[model samples]
Target: MKGSYSLLDIDSSTGDVYLAKGASIGICLGAVKVPRVNPDTRNVTYAGTMSGCSNCFSSDGTGTLYNLSATAVSTKIRPTSVLGSLDVATGEPRDSVAVRRGPSAGMVVDGKNRFAVAAFTAPEGTSYIGSGTAFVPDNNATGQMVIIDLTTGDVVRTMSGFRVGGHGGSLVHGGLMNSVQLDPSTRTGWTYGPYHEQIHQFSY
Candidate 1:
């Protein structure tokens, strides 16, 4: 069960196992047991972190939360490269990128079997690299949509610079985002974070 500090995954049928450490890490992993035990709870019970997060299932029938933050490349912070799957069971990932920054907060899997990551961004770099602030001026500004292709385990596209400067008196902060969904039937992706108020649509 993914919670404020721990990640747990349990296979309802076979009882396989997986786990991530820390409260923030666990939250990002999500919790499978919560839904089964508490019907009133929402799917996003667990939140993630900026450095250690991912979505995984545990052997105990629980969900997982994880982070996909940017990795250091030479001297600059690049989003294209990051550590492999934080899940020990999955070992290291092959084609994966930190689709989000400042703690990927939340993510949803589409019926098409692809993952659409929500994160902050600026300058439209190679990946999700934003200050995580909802809205900021100049260097701390945040805006962008990070898309991850689950099938290929790699970032397919990025919608960055959707907004500039805090609009409508809203200040940007590195916190939970409220834009990210997928339409299974149509294979469309949507992302609307605080920085970019506009709802973004995309096709795989």
Candidate 2:
């Protein structure tokens, strides 16, 4: 509770709450296992953490936690971006793969863990340094949606030329691209931005 908390996701199967903590590394950056049983009290136990993980999703069947690393803070710059997988029970990293887009925002993993979709906020004329806290997006910046294969970690498809902007919080917290949801049964997904009219839909 001490660190700055941003994005949040829940594993419906286990009732675990996954939280993204800004400026925190290691175990403190992931989920807090069912910290509360009733309304007044909280437990707040650590689930796990991955370097630069700003957004996370948990698979219902396997309980594997998938996170997106959008920036490289140690190198003092934003890199291409990466997606990492972790075993929720043991709190260990299972797999990691590079993402094709840079400065990504929201992400969602399919129910079967077959694929993941991410929303990207293209930083057209801005320069990002040290986790993108100073990034400033220009008018030329456009939105992109990418589908990544979970098994091979490959970008299967990309959709671009949409309205996108990184204007909410600091880029390190995923800017304005902070909302993504997927319906595994229909293979449909939705992404949202700060503007109410900017909601987008996709199908796989």
Candidate 3:
């Protein structure tokens, strides 16, 4: 509420709001946790921070929070996944740590399947530093989707499609600007195609 924020998510299970500090185009600063009910009348607290700028934040039906992070790299930057929870009552550090890592950005939580689906649309190679904010992807590379286990933070599968710009094309195309849709019942998900006019879908 006091500082600048670029992205935010309400924990579906807890009602707590998370604000990610960032900009239209820049490196990651950090994040804050605002509890639904302020125990002891506290305003807010820093739940977590990382070296890589967080790309997205999502919470599952069960209140499990997830985020995609990109660290600056000379070669292609491999994104990370932060999975955990913040205490709903007082916003205690149940520890929303960076559990696992993958490629690209965009994500959705399938609580029923206990999985997080991410968009691996980063160009064949892109840096996470300046690119993290500008989100300028290679534009020539195809897009990909990744399925990660919520409990173990393990990437279970990956699906790909051509001409998808999520690799960073536009910060909005894949990172904070776009999204991934999931149908847990059918184990299906969707992503963006920055190079063309098409919505890519994947089944796993």
Candidate 4:
């Protein structure tokens, strides 16, 4: 309750929701019970703090909570592009995997919980707020798409050098990479940056 809530996901298995908070300062995870009589007024229970977390997801089948940590705020304060796994039922951390890139933005897990895809935006300060737009292109920083093996928490593959962070007339507010969604049936994924004009698509 002390920080701003940024992202949220629901676990289909137990109907529990997980939340990520604090974008600029330290990050924390929270949860709330479902089937509430009033959705807007329901109370949220604090889980615990996860340093540098930008987003989180709950697997429908396995009830596993995945958290994304980005940025290099400090060596002891935050981690640069790290993925953390937590037990949904107990809120206990299971694993922490380091990503090759930094400042990761979004992530999505497959329906079967076999794999996940994460998006990385351009380096920090690559974009700045503009007069009429949410963001203005600055440095020619690009983005990356990374695929990971969920069970093993290993990087399967990485696609880099894509336009991001207000590059090539593409503008995004706050950060370049925003969110990632996956379609298990089609084996396709879509990455979105709110201020950008195009949607990034990839297949695996």
Candidate 5:
């Protein structure tokens, strides 16, 4: 495997960082797809992302990141259906062309196994620009959150017109859909993005 793998394998008996370079440069966190092999037919299978970072955000009085630079965010990826065949002879991510480029932040999954990715849409701002300093906003005041559909290999949606650090209280960067939560009892979903500390509530 010439390319690098981001996931790591941990030993139960030992507290060690077994995998090398599991973290993406410039604060990459969120979801990823892992490949597995079945011994019986030598078939390949996929597992969802294990763990990742959440673009840290400052919370309002309610612990929600709303239209703020410090808003927490992340990316998520999961298989909707088997896009690749189980045949190990030819199944090594061959049927997919989904390559994400940006600072990955948070991820969330729904009942249908669909994944929502949240991140700062500044590939040139965070990852490529500095070591760990402040993110030099993309065009200074223009930012957005890109949502990709892993099942269809396309970007399904995007929440644009988000301002980074415009709220005058700490660098209000990007919305890190990191605090998405669903209440099964009420069948309600809550998604908080970057802004002046407001929670966007939705229902099913």
Candidate 6:
């Protein structure tokens, strides 16, 4: 936990913050870590990890965690990703499916926990910034957005043309607001433009 961190979600049962991190920022080492300090006592309370999970985990506001990508080892991108969930209390994977399109740019579950929408960056090639630094080049690539049924692990509908230029290998990165949020009753959502500063609305 001495490296850079990207906050993924919070475990409601314990109030612990779970994060996706790397040896440095803007890269992933292929694990999600949850380490927390009790607010009242300011003491280390709990620490746990979920191996092989990355980007976009949403809590159903109960205890269920929905994730976009997971694997057995550190693979940045593949033809497909194993979409799954983790136990909020233990940081262990509960269930998964090989139906996700690719690595997620962002994701959100509906208020009912019955469905999810995620951004998948199409698999292209990768480039290295340093001898051991590897990253997905998002500058000229496009991504897909999909609506999925959580229970059946099936992608019911998909929308293409989302962009994926999340972050470069720089020590400092910004403007990569590639996440999603939803309004249940309306069945609509919004996200930032993939290449520019514009807000796009999604209705599906």
TM-scores for every candidate against the unseen true structure: 0.42, 0.71, 0.64, 0.66, 0.36, 0.66
- Expressed as tens digits, the lDDT of each residue in 1-204 for candidate 4 is 454454567666555566654244333333332211123456566454454345444453465666665544343332346677666457577768876544455667785748878765653322222222113255555677778887787889877655545222112111323356777888888765445677877786
Candidate 2: worst 10 consecutive residues by lDDT?
A: 31-40
Number of the top candidate by lDDT? 2
Off by over 4 Å in 6: 1-3, 10-16, 22-32, 36-44, 70-79, 90-92, 122-142, 167-178
Q: Residue 177 of model 5: what lDDT?
A: 35
List model 1 lDDT by residue over 6-69, tens digit each: 3344334433333343223122222122222223342232222224433222221223223333
Number of the top TM-score candidate: 2
Worst 10 residues of 3 by lDDT: 21-30
lDDT of each: 0.38, 0.59, 0.54, 0.55, 0.33, 0.56
lDDT of 6 by residue, 1-204 (tens): 365555456555556554543222333446655545455666653344553344555666566666555342233333244566766556566767776433456677884647888765553245343322224466555666788888898889888676644443222211123267688788888776746477668876
User: Against the true structure, candidate 6 has what lDDT?
Assistant: 0.56
- Cα lDDT of model 5 by residue, 1-204, tens digit: 234543332222222212212333233434334444344465544432222322222112111111111212332211111111112224232343332443334333332334333434343343423223334554544444445454564666655444323221112222233444545456455554457376655543
Candidate 1 overall lDDT versus native: 0.38
- List pairs with backbone clashes in candidate 4: none
Worst-scoring 10-residue span by lDDT in model 6? 169-178
Candidate 3 — number of clashing residue pairs? Answer: 10
Better of 2 and 3 by lDDT: 2
What are the per-model C-alpha RMSD values against the true structure? 9.1, 5.2, 5.9, 7.5, 13.2, 5.9
- Decoy 2 TM-score against native: 0.71
The digit string of per-residue lDDT tens for model 2 on 68-180 reads 76554353544556787767688777778888535566677785748888777663334555443335446555677788888888889887755554435444435533466
Query: For candidate 3, lDDT tens digit of each residue in 75-190?
Result: 23344445444433343445444534443456677888888776654433433553422244555545666677877767687665534444433453235634677788998766
Model 5 has an lDDT value of 0.33
Which should have the higher TM-score, number 2 or number 3? 2
Clashes of each: 35, 1, 10, 0, 19, 0
Q: In model 5, which runs have C-alpha deviations exceeding 4 angstroms?
A: 1-99, 111-113, 121-143, 162-177, 182-189, 193-196, 201-204
